[model samples]
Target chain A: MKLLESRGLLTLALAGAFLWSLTGVDWGSPLIHTGGGAAARTFFLALFPPDLSPDFLGVALAATWPTLAYAVAGMTVAVLIGIPLGILASGTVVSSPALRLPAALVSRFSLGGLRAIHELVWAVLFVAAFGLSPLAAVLALGLPYGGILGRIYAELLHDVPPEPLRALRTAGASPMRQFLYGRVPLALPDMISYTFYRFECAIRSAAIMSFVGIQGLGYQIQLSLHDLLFRQVWTLLLFMLLLVVLVDQWSSLVRRKLAA
Target chain B: MKVAAVTAPAATQLAAEGIAKSYPGVQALAPISFTVSPGERVALAGPSGSGKTTLLYLLAGLLQPDSGRLCIEGQDLTAMRPGKELARLVGMVHQQFDLVGSLPVVHNVLAGRLGQWSLASSAMSLIWPRERRLAQEALERLGIADKLNQRTSKLSGGEQQRVAIARLMVQSPRIILADEPVSSLDPALAEEMMRLLVELVEDSGKTLIASLHSPYLIKKYCSRVIGLRRGQVQFDLPAAELTEAVLDRLYDLKAERI
Candidate 1:
């Protein structure tokens, strides 16, 4: 009875809050602008017949490589940054009660600070500081991705079954040793799987950087969209979809092999 | 019975004085005092909520007691920093076996020596496991050398227990604690696991404190049996004197005997 009451209360509160939030926009005003409906409909129609021209295919193929390269390179840097920071933030590596909380908090705050900024904002900032360069795009993607990965890695490390770690503790493995033998090994599968999932997100984010003059799939997407060549846009979107599908298949394969 | 360990007995094995622990509202353990000597095979027997595991945790320094002192060889465990000395002094086997299921059997066994290894050697060993012989020998002794490279979780319950015992043997701490170590296995496998563990402990002459469900196994292996009820000691008797009458009271079994 108590459980149902609390659950019902929570549901009501959420519904009320959602309804309240809807008031922020004026419902009387038409949400779509003049001709917007036609544009949206045309965009949807183009999906059925994407451009198959040989030259556009070549452009998409070229764009695909750089997008893939940026994602891999950016994720490489993110993982490098994430693993070390994640270890520190996990509080598993720090045994001293005095330091563990503060250390975790600082690392968590740093991760939060990094992750708080959107990837697009980071790309703009990096471009402003370093000029329009591939390195800038990589850094922009890597920093936020690293923060997200580090926070998740820390959570994974913490989520490891305490019994194994406790057994290690009683066995007298030092803090660092306990983490290496106990926590890290247990969390590895989940951490790897999550990293791959995050890498998929990074692929899309890398493509998005094209708007900031970082040439990739998104740059081509922008140009195609601007020229109102919706068919060309569909072709680019198809290529992006193919990339995501490939990554999805590859990651699942890796997961299966590990599980096996 | 084993006379001495490879690592010689410290002057005292472990002594707890008025040690107690409780969660937020419930007192898990009342203040309790006891001492365990080197080479002693002790069994902790109790009903479901008897605080046997809690006592073992306090002894292992895995959990801090709300009050009182715990010492191993006169070194206060509560204050002791974890390092080589602590690593060499104590080891534990959990009900779950506490093996990292994803890791291979060999790595789990070699993890016993992570404290002894230099940071460099330990790191390198992760990639190029140096002490294969030690791990192999422990597994061979436990009759599971074939399982050395196998992922730990893939092994059956009985086999995983062997891996855990093999890891403990490699650890070779002077004091060993087991919390229902064989509870997860079948009757036959449990007996076999118990026998192997006893043989190893006997050979090394290390202190063994196991919390057990089976009175038969407890009487068969332990020299001293401590019975607990409601977070307090009911009896701390020699195994011979741990008669059926006491067992009935310990477990609150009204009319059953085994």
Candidate 2:
């Protein structure tokens, strides 16, 4: 009976997904175009022997700074906004029942609203509103990233061991005091690790945001691709990969130190 | 040692009147009343699920009684907010050694005084630990002074337990509530920990209320015993009067069924 019940549920879920996919998609179209595949293969082959001209290299290096700066600035804003919102959403700091529910609901709703819009969509909206400034890209990255970080932060706070928290409460520590001394210290390592992961995501998002006229590696890649300069595109791609690798190395070092 | 009559009208160090606690489906602690004088060592002894932990939590002001009153140092607990004053008066040693494992031993010990410090001071201490000497002294008393800079997770179970005691020593509360503090230790370690705890409380003239599983340890260290069964106090007697027959009766499943 249980097997049949689970199978029925699985069937329903698959049918629902199939129905959903039917909207706005042309099912009659060929799944792959042979000509497009050849072009993609050509692009892949051009990845080797990338453009290393001094002028283009200088441009790539300059673009690298903007990408890193946007990510850092956006993440700085995200951390500032996320930590407080996460604490509010976690509902651990408040003791009074009257305040806890509303605080949790409001903060959670705001987080959901922010992250519901993808960073690219947010960038388009900000560009419309703010007229293509660096602020538009930064805000676009900050809002959605803050929402994701806040949600994860709330979960980390909630997932901490209750024994130490209970012992702090028993020692007559106030709710804020308990949170600062007992809860935050215990959750700090996990929070730092998650933030680093988010920072890597933010870098990728910043690169993508350049498509909306922001100045970064993505903009350079788009311009090169438009002129059919595959070599330049490959060079820009290499720069992006190098940036990600450096950040990944740094993150692992920090996490290893935390563990030790 | 003076054994003040349990009914003495004079204000005691700790008092509970009809204190009780209940969960959705279980009565974890039934309404019971007791008093402890200054400088007394009391042991709460019971089988599993006999409300020993519940009672200790209530006394520590961690759990509010569904229906009763508690007074610590003659101040009503229910009327006042649990904060620095209450923290300064009551400390608890948990069975699980609830120190932050990633933090250094000195930081964990210094956390004992967090309630007493201003928010600014507490925040500053995270970067530049204030009162390092006090924390060092507490660790010295526990014979783990050299481990002060070591991360708490690196310590053994016994050393971690001693770090917990060092934290309590830094707290310097007049009343200490220990919830099965030695439950995780071996027999020899448990005995030594209990003896140290009793001696510390006695030397400082503090009130000690500890929930203990070992009848032998209770007889050896505690001045009084409160035997609980099924959320109620079955017997409250001087240690000398808590004989083996009393324990047998206290733990008898056959008698409980009847």
Candidate 3:
């Protein structure tokens, strides 16, 4: 009887839901049409021959800066917010038993609340509240990303070997002292690597923020697609792809240096 | 190395009366009374579950006893808040050699003084080490000066243990507590480490209390032995009186069987 309600059954239920969703697709209504499908085909075919015109190439190049700037600025804000919240949520620096529990609970709850709203939703909300400004995009990216970074940082601090921390405590070191000498150095490599990974995600998020009227590669792509310039869309997309690749290489280099 | 003569002190270095600790369901340590004087090497000898570590932790002020009074240099540990004063007075060498793996040997050794430094200084030391010469001197004393800049994780277990000892050396505490500090080492390395610890204590005229698993090591280095069984003191006697018969009884083995 228990076997019928096991993990296998749960998996089967998920598969059933997915299969059911497939039934809602309209298979007969020109799924591949004369307008959209041909445009998509042209977009795919133009991958090899992206717009090489110097003026258009310059526009794509120019758009890349703001995308990079937004990502860097947003991540900086994220890190600034994340580290302190992470320290609090980790409960590593709170030694008094009376305060540690409440501190941990409040910080953890705040992080969860911040991350629960998707970045796009946050952007939309911010757009409504503050109009279409770069500040809105930056805050939208920063809030969710900070929450994620904070949660990861907390877990990393908590997961460090207890022995070293205990040794520091036994030596009459303060909670902050224990964190600085024992926890931070031990958890640093993991924190650095995770932060870089989030930076990559920040880039993608910054591009998507364009839908709310922030100018970036996504805005360029959106405009080109509306104008039926599939080649230009492909060109802007290549720029975004190039940016991602560059960030990946940079992250790898930084991680390698840290490891060394 | 010559054993340092026990000098009569104005006050005991460590005095514990009726010190007891209990976990959720188990009494880890029973009410036991003991006083350790200056310049004495005392070994706590016991089996695995005999509460040696619990006693050490209580003495180190890492865990507060449920009942009893503990004093260091006439200062009440329980009444006073935990701070650098207690750390300045006592040093502990852990069984696991609790050095941070990602840090260099110099940084791990310098951590001994973290309690003494201001918060700003401690943070600043991470970027620019404030006491490099002092750290190097301690490591040099431990004979690992060559490995000063190497990451602690890359060192061998025995080397790491030396690093732990070097950290304690830098601490320069008046009373030293070692919790099975050499239990992880081979017999030869254990003896060398034990000898070095004894020599350091002797030279500084500090109180040394170490929980040792091996009876032979205790008999060789320690002037006195406190035997514990089931969280209570079974015997407290000079090392010369700890005979094979007493050890067998301390271990609770039948005479005929032994």
Candidate 4:
């Protein structure tokens, strides 16, 4: 135990592992492809003077609307799926010690299975099954986001101060009443904040859904990249960034209100 | 209009016969026997580890004793289910006065009525806050009606205690159990709260059993005092009979060491 706690020995072991891992790279050969340096330089240079032409701007703005729409639609579904499952997974709402364990285990397993598959993978699977519908993109973002949010919400509900819940219990409140009055109210501010954070993530996820053939900002960016219209790609990237920033700011405002 | 009828708590007797409880390595209570008549105000007083809170929990039906029997209104308390049946018999005011902090004061007060509300109506009350007048009347009785819409967490400590009292009034359980209901208050405020509490219990014809640290407040507010030490009852006496020597013995450190 003392050896494990030693700082010098730990550092030595970490350094040794790093040096051994470095041996796998070939130092004698050129790592970069021919003309790769020039292509990188051009990409970096396009970031400065983004394509601000009226025609290109029109296309970028049009794509931004669909991206925003998809994110909202997806988050609506995520919230719907998240709140109920989160309550079930919390295990605090179930008072019967005999039943709480199995119920919690099942819900925990469900949430884990959901988050284990990434949103991008779900998108591909959904697009394959649904064939290019907007619902596919919404479901893809919603499923994983629901899982992530449910996990967080369950923890929040579980972690509410026990004093209030105990007071409710001895006051003869049922488990569900204790949850609604004690746990949910106390945990609401944090839950709202986390849901807002997840909404921001949903926007990014919705934009990425374009790679699976859904029409949005990511698809436009892909098209510009394929044609090597790097300037237009930068413009499209800015629109995505703007959407994320707006949602983040809006979420922050809502959280402050909730806290108050 | 029916919701606003704050009916007086029912007259109910509480009895404990040779009831004892033990945790992993400590005995929380030992063969304590007592009976509280309806409309009686009793105070359980002792040091920090004197089993007062544990005894109160047992009476509230929050904990079960390992041995002996507890009866409420002549029925077995241990057999009681944790729903409206138990709710009708017991209501508790926490030492911390556990009001839902983020919610409006009205909602926290109204939560006392949840035992009687259906799941759908309770959920809907979050939006519409049904029976607003009853909640307002409870706060008004406690002299905090102006704070009806204020968030519970934002209230002062004294105000929060009043809110807990108001909630109990709305609940109108046959028996009210309080654990240090005035622990966090200043001397004047504590005395004021005790007076108000005693008055409320008397006016409504309800039973009250509170565990308190201060002998003065206990004597001033409660009709009977039950002093405990090391999870055993030391003395059961009337408030007028609580003399200084008896108090010294009750709080004696030398005897406690034994």
Candidate 5:
């Protein structure tokens, strides 16, 4: 009898919660959300109606340089900072209990904090600090990518064979020597593959940063959307998609070759 | 004993006095004393959990004994930095084979020289074609010269063991510590591996202390054998003196009287 009563009360609570959700829900908002297949449908209905607005395309082409530059620059700095810091963060490379624990803690928290904030949020902060320039995009991209790359690098460094390290140590190889010889070579392929993957992500991130007055393909997409020229927006979207696809293919091919 | 007359045992490659280790629930090794002389082929024969592994770890400087001293070449191992300096004198092969499976056979053999190489050069793989030649030589010595370019995973169990042996050959440490070096092989391959190990150690003028389960093989290859039971050295004697009575006692299995 008590079990039956409990089931009745549980059902009542769920019904109440469902009714409450009904009160605040705006279910229709999703129907018109930007790029929610509505604009996509409008875009395709125009069917090869090319938005070859030379003026707009010129602006996009001009912004393309900054987009490519920021992504490349950001990735280079991210990799440079990430690799060494990642090695330091990985206890396998340190092998000292006194320093390893604290270094690991710092690395985890710092990287976690960097990752918690989105690149858009970072761009806003950098724009405010540096006053709306290409530098803002670079800084915005660097932290998040560095955090990602560092975490991956640390994991790879830790996972490599300890046998080689032991062998090196026995041969009187220094800790640095052991890591360089034993750990780095094993981790190189994975790192390169992941970095290329990140480069793809950085391309998108660079475009997003342009909304804060920095210029890229994203800036063009945002402008086209604002003007309600859905056709032009599709072109920018196509370009971004093409870039992502190319980077994805390149990463896989490179990884395969490196593995070979 | 006058100062001029006092001469320590220079022939002794390793000496352990009162080495002990304990985990949370169990004592791994307890107050064990042992020694290995240069060119001596010794076997540590025991069942699982007999402290054979712990003893091997202590001798190889892979694990620190909670209490005791380990001396190699009259230099105190426990006194130096934990894995850093202790590794120089000891070459160890773990039971799992602990190989870099993706690496080529020659690269794995060349891994023995990682300790000898510098950080910059090691990263660059700048040890040159000569290093590869040396690795090839080591592989040749172990009769796997053709497998130099093949991935280590492509090799069979016995072949992998030979690759490991080749790595040890390149390491050229004063003492070689092998844990269950032939436990996974067939009887013939096991015998062959043991024979090769013995020959290599003898040729290099180094001491070998191998942990194993097979008493027959121990008797055949090793000059001396140490029997362990429940973290204690149950017996330490010449291989010829390891009688059936001792085996029965160590294994705790009674003989069937016909």
Candidate 6:
């Protein structure tokens, strides 16, 4: 009875603390500011019936190349930089404490810092640094994608079976051999699947990061919205959605093949 | 028909001197000393958590004893790192089968030799010029040559054990340390496995040390039996001396003649 009473009291106290923490915060979003305080709700209705006009298809097509370029460039850089870092960071290849600890710390910090900053924020920084160029968009995607892929690769490396590793260890095989024969074979399928999945995500991130003058689908969407051409916005969105769907299907097929 | 000739002499294949291990609030093994000669098949029999597995790990160079020295084929393992060389010297079959489920039986068997091959050789062998000869030879030895391409998950418990045996055969280590290798199998399959294990040990003239719970199996297969109780050696004697009184004392059960 005493324990139950104490638990209830503790719960009540925690709830009070949570309520207190939210006391002075502004709940409304800055994105939907209403003029004249007349309960204006235009932005709420702005996204209504998501504009689908035939005339906007050309605009959408025009932006496709830039978006695709952003995604491809970003993911390539990510893969190039992430794979080695990830392998080094994982417990599979770097089993020694002296090596694993420092490698893990670096991988974690780099990935965490990259992921913490939104890609849009990264684009803003790149725009400020590199001027209004596609390089800004590419770097924006590349930095975060590299970080995310590195973490994923590390996880894949770590999840391989330990028995093969143990066998390799006992045979007086080198660490590199253990990784190549033992860890690589075990993790190949999952690693490939994850990389493709990340590529799909890169496509989505690439579109969003085009706000700083890289004429991608997202740029078209932003322009159409500013002009209140809801139909054009929907067309751009549909094109983006189509790319996502295509990549999704491709990745599913690849995953199934690898699994088989 | 020609039988496989014994390959080596009984010159201390494995020697452990004054081994001791302790975990937080648990004394797992204490000041144990033992040696296994080439061509000798020794069984360490005990109940759960009796330090049999720990002793196997220590012998296999999988774990370093807090205070002990280990030598396999006159090479010191106490100072050696756990890698390809150590793996080549000692082959271990864990109780859990430890077979990578998604991999084919052949690949699992071939894994035993991965430590011997160069990194480039092993990596390239993953796709092109696969070590078909080595894998087939291993499976053939275990009488599961047809099951080489089959996924390990599809195999029965007995088949998995055979695959493990095949892997050990391919590894061809100087010492074989198996921990509860047949605890999960039925009595018949376990016996068959023990027979194969003993035959392989004797054939290669390599040291074989296995941990088992079944006294009948141990007596039927191993000439020497070491009984451990509560992290200490209770009895180390020939199978003929494993009397009912000693068995009861080791297991703390009522004495009954086998």
Top model number, TM-score: 1
* Order of candidate numbers by DockQ, starting with the best: 1, 2, 4, 3, 6, 5
Q: Write the candidate numbers in order of decreasing TM-score.
A: 1, 2, 4, 3, 6, 5
Q: What is candidate 3's lDDT per residue for B80-191, written digit by digit as tens?
A: 6565777777889898888888888888888888878898998898889988999899888888899999988899988898888888887878889999988888898899
- Error (Å) of candidate 5 at residue A63 is 5.3
Q: Which digits, one per residue and each the tens of the lDDT, describe model 5 over residues B98-168? A: 66666678777776776665556566663353378888888888888999888777789888888888878
DockQ of all candidate complexes: 0.61, 0.56, 0.55, 0.55, 0.37, 0.48
> Which stretches in model 2 have alpha-carbon errors above 4 Å?
A1-29, A53-55, A94-98, B1-11, B253-258
Question: Residue A222 CA error for candidate 2 (Å)?
Answer: 1.2
The model with the greater TM-score, 1 or 5, is: 1
Clashing pairs in 3: none
Judging by lDDT against the true structure, name the best candidate. 3
The alpha-carbon lDDT assigned to residue A193 of candidate 2 equals 87
**Lowest summed-lDDT stretch of 10 residues in model 4 chain B?**
B1-10
* CAPRI grade of model 1: medium
How large a fraction of the reference contact set does each model reproduce? 0.61, 0.55, 0.58, 0.59, 0.39, 0.54
Between candidates 4 and 5, which one is better according to lDDT?
4
**Which 10 residues in a row give candidate 4 chain A its minimum summed lDDT?**
A165-174
Per-residue lDDT tens digits for candidate 2, residues A70-101, read 99999998898799899999999888999999
User: What TM-score, over all chains together, does every model reach?
Assistant: 0.90, 0.89, 0.87, 0.89, 0.82, 0.84
Q: What is the DockQ of candidate 1?
A: 0.61
**Cα lDDT computed for each candidate against the true fold:** 0.86, 0.86, 0.87, 0.86, 0.78, 0.78
TM-score for candidate 2, residues paired by index: 0.89
Docking class of predicted structure 3: medium
A142 Cα displacement, candidate 6 (Å): 1.1
Flag clash pairs in model 5.
A168-B115, A170-B87, A173-B115
